[model samples]
Target: MREADRTTRQRLADALRAEPATPSELAAQFDLTPNAVLGHVEHISRSLDRSDERFLVAPPTCRDCGFDDFDDLLNLPSRCPGCKSEAVTEPTFTIE
Candidate 1:
């Protein structure tokens, strides 16, 4: 299908298939907010065919302390637990 005919979710899925992406990267590419990209990622994940494809998420981490153990993998954390740092890395997503 032509790019113009594809939905935002479709384009986002295509991008994921092409390579892994952070929410920020996806948001910038698609002209959407990071939160909006997360919403689309969630939708795409739910809609995937389990037999043919899988949606994978790399958990968010703390940039300062490299702490990857987050309580909620889906939600972007505001603060790091290991260190009181606000520099948390965004989770990465991909389709495989």
Candidate 2:
């Protein structure tokens, strides 16, 4: 389908299926805010629950200590619990 013919959520799902990408990356590609991309991701994830495909998230990690375990996997934390670093990478999402 043409890009203009599809909904925002549908475009987002198609992007994820192509390759894993962070919210920031997707936001820029789709011309939306990171928060907006997150919202689309949440909806797409729910829709995929019944399908054989899976919505996978490579959780955010701290640039300082490389910590990837956070209480909330979707949102980016200001500080890393392991290293207390302010530099944290946003989680990458992909459909597998």
Candidate 3:
């Protein structure tokens, strides 16, 4: 099927199954904003809960101090709580 014909969530799921990717990567692949991709990913996570597959998250980290203690895995933080740095790495997701 043509990529344009597929739903955004379907495209996101397909990309993630093919390989683990950050939200930014998915956003680029789906031609969406990173925040938009996060919304789809959140729904994907819930959908996987009732299926045989599972959604895996590689939690975002603070590039400055290697902090990975963000309470919410679905939303990217603007700054690190540990070092107060804005250089935080986006979380990666995959299906397994």
User: TM-score for every candidate vs. truth?
Assistant: 0.90, 0.92, 0.93
Using TM-score, rank the candidates from best to worst: 3, 2, 1
Give a tens-digit lDDT track for model 2, residues 29-92: 9899998898889989999999999999999989889899898877857799997889998999
Please write out the lDDT profile of model 3 over residues 1-96, one tens digit for every residue. 998799889889998999999989988877899999999999999999999999999999998899998999998899999989999999999998
The parts of candidate 3 lying over 4 Å away from their true place are 1-4
Candidate 3 overall Cα lDDT vs. reference? Answer: 0.93
lDDT of each residue in 13-77, candidate 1, tens digit only? 99999999999999999999999998888889889955589998999988888999998776778
Q: Could you give the C-alpha RMSD of every candidate to the true structure, in order shown? A: 1.4, 1.1, 1.3
Model 1: what TM-score? 0.90
Clashing residue pairs found in predicted model 1? none
Which TM-score value belongs to model 3? 0.93
Question: What's the TM for model 2?
Answer: 0.92
Candidate 1 vs 3: which has more TM-score: 3
lDDT against the true structure, each candidate: 0.91, 0.91, 0.93
